[model samples]
Target: MEFRYLGNSGLKISEITFGNWLTHGSQVENDVAARCVRAALDAGISTFDTADVYANTAAETVLGEALKGERRQSLEIFTKVFGPTGPKGHNDVGLSRKHILESIDGSLTRLQTDYVDLYQAHRYDFQTPLEETMQAFADVVRQGKALYIGVSEWTAEQLRNGHALAKALGFQLISNQPQYSMLWRVIEAEVVPASEELGVSQIVWSPMAQGVLSGKYLPGRPAPEGSRATDEKGGANTIKRWLADEVLSGVQLLKPIADEAGLTMPQLAIAWVLQNKNVASAIMGASRPEQVAGNVAAAGVVLEPGIMNQIDAAIGSLAERDPAQTKSPASREA
Candidate 1:
């Protein structure tokens, strides 16, 4: 697998990071999930991404069990805070000092690791003072619970402010995890430039636009059964916006583009995101073991400028590029 440096840090992770967001502990059986992790490792993936909030913390336990015997030094493990993982108590969420301090220990325990390579705030906590959050992150670094810090779905201004505070506190904010894909370009306008200046790379999630770019969902028809669009657990809700006829019709135009590039629709989609120099890694999750290696093939593949232009034309006016769209919860109440 191809590797790239994460931000300005010397640490490098696999181009395609294995992530378990909606599948692990929720949509798949433990054995199936473990097989997918095995598939990722067999395919040369060394980076694994998860969150404490995923499946109410069961996902981490499953991942920990799946990766029990691997050499820890060889893997780049990441997890997130600022989500209600436990029983949704008053102190269960946000980036408050109490939550940040308490959550990392829980995350470490669940992941079966003493320290995560990078610990990210899942979302911006508008209610908490940014100083409190960054200070807590700095302390986590000093305590060796996490080697680096990052934030997800934060606005450009929020990243700048947080980066400044993290610097003042003596720990670097090296990455930002955002939902990015050929159809979702919100980060390109503002966050990318700000992160570029701040020396932060993007660990983009949903590079397939939650399977919308896979070209399996055709326009003017009902979603195929057993697909994410039909998943009642939560996947259906997250992918519903892209189920519109207009978006689906526009997505259909990419099939020929993928054929010309000698890539599956999903591979083309994943490769499209990695073309950005500021993107350190693109997170890909799979429900089946067989799907892992196919997506990983997109890692080192480079699309020519003409193919890139064709992609833009195919999805023209259907993409979401408004800089105002990259935001987190207005208030993540604990």
Candidate 2:
């Protein structure tokens, strides 16, 4: 597997990271999740990404159990905070010092590890002071709970402020995890540039646009049974926006491109994201072992510049490129 340094940090992560977001605890049973993890490991994926709020904390427990016998020093395990994971208490969420401090212990316990390679803010906490959040992250690093810090889906302005604070406070904010895909170009206009200049690389999520770019959801037909679009308990809701006929038709246009490149649609999608120099890794989620094997082949596959232009043309106006649209919710609720 190809590995890249996460932003300017010394830590190297696999180009394809196995992530458990909707599949680990909600969509798939623990045994199936373990099989998928085994597949990722067999495929040489050393980076695993999860979040405390995923499946209300069960995802981390399952992941920890799955990697029980693996050498911990060889893996780059990452998890995030900022969402409410337990009882609906006011203080059970956000980036407050209290929440971050308490959350790290719970995460470490559930992860079966003493420290995570990276701890990210799942979303910007508008309710907390920026300095308070950065200082709490610095404390997390100082305490050795996490080796580095990252943020997910934060606006460029917020990232700049956070990076500046992290620098002043003596911690490295090395990565940003955003929802990037062949269809979602929101990060390209501003987030990528800001992160590039600030020494932060993007570990993008949803490089397949919630499976839309896989070309499985054909136009003029119902979603395939058990597909993400039909799995309400998993990604159905989030993927609805990409189910329109125009988008599906555009995706269909790329099938020939994949054929020409000898890549599966998913591989094409994943490789397209990796083409960006600022993207350190693309997180992939799977409920089955073969799915893991299929997607990881995109690692180290470089798409010709001409093929990338063809992708843009095929997606046409379906791509969302507005930098302003890259935003987080205004409030953190339990």
Candidate 3:
């Protein structure tokens, strides 16, 4: 696997990061999840990403157990906060200092690790002062709970404010996790520029659009049985926005393009995201071992300029490029 420096940070992560968002702890059996993680390792992937809120925090525990006995220093493990992972309470969510402090401890316990390579704010907490959030992150680094800090789905303004605070406080804010895919280009117009200027690389999630870009969900047909579209445990709901006929049909048109490049549709989609110099890694999730092997093959494959232009022409109009569309909850309401 190819390794790239995460922004300007000294750490290097695999080009394709194994992530467990919807598949681990909830969708797949423990044996299946463990096999997928093993597949990632066999394919030379050393970076794993998860969030405390995934499957109500079970994802972290599963990932931790999956990585047990591996040389910890060889892997770059990342997890997130800023979601409601606990019981209903006022301080149970957001990026408040209290939440950040408490959330890291719970995450460490669940992951069976003392320190995460990168700790991210899953979303901007508008209810809390940016200063409080940044300071709390600095404290996390100071306390050695997290080696670095990041944010996810944050707008250009939010990143700038947070980066400024991080700079003043003498800490590194090295990454942003956004939903980036062949059909989702919201990060292109604004977030990318802001992140590039601020020296923060993007570790993008949903690089396959929840498997839609893989050509498994056909246009003018029922979603394949047991596909993410039929997964009622949040996957179906998350993928509904991309289920429109136009989008699915547009995706279908890319099949020929994939053939021309001697690649699978999913590989083409992943390589497309990595073409952006601002992206440090493309986060991929899988339910099976073969899926992990197939996706990781896209790590070092570079698309020719003409192929890239063809991709843009094929799905350009169908893509979401509106900077305003990149949003976070004003306050994660309970």
Candidate 4:
């Protein structure tokens, strides 16, 4: 597990970070989640990502329970806010000062830790004043409730403005979590450039396109049962966007390149994302220990120029057909 500086901050994190989205609370039981966390730590993943909204706040509890026997100081935990955790009520969520303050306390309690390594606003909140949100985040840093602050799925302008506010308030905005993958290139248009300019490092999510790049999906066939494509809650949006005809065709086209390099499609896809200097880490969601082990190995495989060219050609071909359809929320460069 290679480690990289998370932006300009002094902290260094594992290149392959373990994140619990659906697999923790919604899909796997606590015992299974604990096993997965142990597997990740064994593989040298020091960073663990979670959110207040995932599984209605159960993910943090599960994670906290799992880490009971491990040395807490050895792990760097990250969690997020700004998503509705309830039944879409007015007071249920957002980046408002009330929500930020209350959410941190709840998260800290559930996580069994006094402070989070990285605390983030999960998304842009159009209703809240940016200053209020920035100040709230700064307060958390000052109060020692969180060590660093970040934002996710925010536009380039939002990242710039937020970082400026944090600096003025005497706080460091260290990272931005966005969906970036070989299949998604929208970030290349502006987000990537903005991060480079502002000295913000990116920790990209869905580096494998949610199993599409894992080579389990194929064109002109029914998706295998029990895969993400078959998940009742997880795969609908992914299937509609990533498992579409054009994307699957692109995956098929890249298979030979992976074979030639003695790599799996997922390994090539993940390495391709890491090749970018701006990407600090790739957050992978794994339901089982073997998946975590496999993903860790991908970080070591170097893609030759010819194999990279084949990937580029496959992406080019996919771009030509309905160029608008390939951008999934996870892959938008921003």
Candidate 5:
């Protein structure tokens, strides 16, 4: 797999990071999940991403077992806190010092690693002071629990403020994990520009729009029996809006573009996101081993300038580009 430096940091990560968001514990069997991890390794992916909130921390355990024998130094393992994990107690969530400190320990234990390559704030914890959170992250770095700090779905303003604080604390906040795809451009107008200025790179999730951009869901048709749109427990809610006729029709327009690029719809989608220099990696989740194999092909792909234009035109008004659309919980109930 091709590698790119994460942000301006000296560390490089596989452009395609294998992530276990929904599949590890909630949706797929443990054996299947392990097989998928093996598939990722076989495909040359050395980067792995997970979060404590995923399946209430069981995902981390599964990931830990999956990577049990690999040389930890050769892999860049990442995990996140700041969500309601384990019984959703009042003290179980947010980026408060208490939660951040305790959560890191739980994460490390579950992942069977002494430290994570990156520890991220799963979302901006509006309920807690930013300083408190940054200071805790600084401690994580200083204590050798995490090598780097990152955040997910943070607004450009939030990133700017958090970065300044992290710098003052003698650490660097180098990455932001955001939902970015052919159909989602919310981060482009503000977040991307600000990140470019601040030396933060995006590790984008759902480059295939939670599988929507794979073009397997057709317009005016019932979702395939086991498609993401049909999996209520996993992705049906997040994917329902894109199932509308207009959106589906728009996605279909890209079939020819993918064909011309000598790539599949999913590869085209992942490649399209990697074309953005600000995006360091596109996180892909797989339920099956072959899915991992198919997605790794997206690594090292270079879309022509003209092909990029075709994607924009094909997605048209269906893409969400409003900077205002980037949001975090106003209160940390989530």
Candidate 6:
């Protein structure tokens, strides 16, 4: 696997890293999760991403249990804060100082690790003061509980303000995780440019558009069985957006280009995201081990400039359809 610097930081993460979002704590059992992690490790993917809210905190516990003894030191683990993980208490959520402090201890205990390679704010918390959040993050780094810190789903202005706060307070804001894919070119707006200017690398999630770019779904067809589209936890929004007529048509338009490039739809989809200089890695989420292997193989299939141009042309069509909904990659770029 190819390794890239996370922003300007010395931390090097795999181009194809495994992530435990919904799979680890929910779909897969303990032994299965362990096998998936081992599959990633064996494939030379050293980074594993998780979040406190994933699977109601069971994701971290399973991840910690999988990285036993010597394996712990050899891997890079990342987890996020600022999501609800509770039996219904208001204090159990958000990026407040109390939540950050309480969450980190729980995460550390569950993962059984002394320090996380990177700790990220799951999203911008409107309720919490950015400075207060930054200060707490800095303290975590100073205390050695987390080596690096990042943010996810932040706006361009928020990223700038956060970076300034980190610099003034002597903390490093290294990266941002965001949803980026061929079909969802929203990050190209302000998020990409801002992240580029500030030296924050983008570790994009959902590069496959949550399987829309995987080529399994076709227009006017029933939702595939055993697919996320049919899964209750996959969320209704995904089904509505992905199964929409225009979205499926867009995917259909890209098929010939992928074929010409000698790549599968998902391979072409993932490779397209990596072509951007700002993207450090694409968090490859897989339920089965073979899915992980297939995703890793996509890193090897190079897309020619012509093929890239074809892809750009196809996706550009969507801008005319709904320009107002475009998302800026300012948080993800550079």
CA error at residue 244 for candidate 5, angstroms: 0.5
Candidate RMSDs in Å, in order, are: 0.9, 0.8, 1.0, 3.4, 0.7, 3.6
Candidate 5 Cα misplacement greater than 4 A, ranges: none
For model 1, how does the per-residue alpha-carbon lDDT over 1-334 read when each residue is reduced to its tens digit?
A: 9999999899999999999776899999999999999999999999999999999999999898999999999999999999896888988999999999999999899889999999999999989999999999999999999999999999999999999998899998999999999889999999999999999999999999999999999988889989999999999998998989899999999999999999999999999999999999999998999999999999999999999999899899999999999999798842
- Write the residue-wise lDDT of candidate 6 on 1-334 in tens digits: 8888999798899988788877787877778888888788888899999998988899999888888774566788999998788673777877788889889988999989989999998888877788899999999999999999999878788889999999988979999998788776666778889999999999999898888888888888877888888777754446467787777877888899988988888888888889888999998888777787778877645678999889878777663223234333322111
Cα lDDT for residue 82, model 2?
A: 91
What TM-score against the true fold does each predicted structure earn?
Answer: 0.99, 0.99, 0.98, 0.93, 0.99, 0.93
Query: Local distance difference test, per candidate?
Result: 0.94, 0.94, 0.92, 0.83, 0.93, 0.83
Query: lDDT tens string, model 4, 48-93?
Result: 9999898989998998888777777788899999887756467668
lDDT of 5 by residue, 174-260 (tens): 999999998999999999999999999999998998888999998888898888888879589988868889999999999999999
In the predicted model 3, the residue pairs found to clash are none
**What's the lDDT for candidate 4?**
0.83
Which runs of model 2 end up more than 4 angstroms from their true locations?
Answer: none
Clashes of each: 0, 0, 0, 4, 0, 10
Comparing 1 and 6 on lDDT, the stronger one: 1
Output the lDDT of residue 180, model 2: 93
State the lDDT at 245 in candidate 1: 88
lDDT: worst 10-residue window of model 2: 325-334
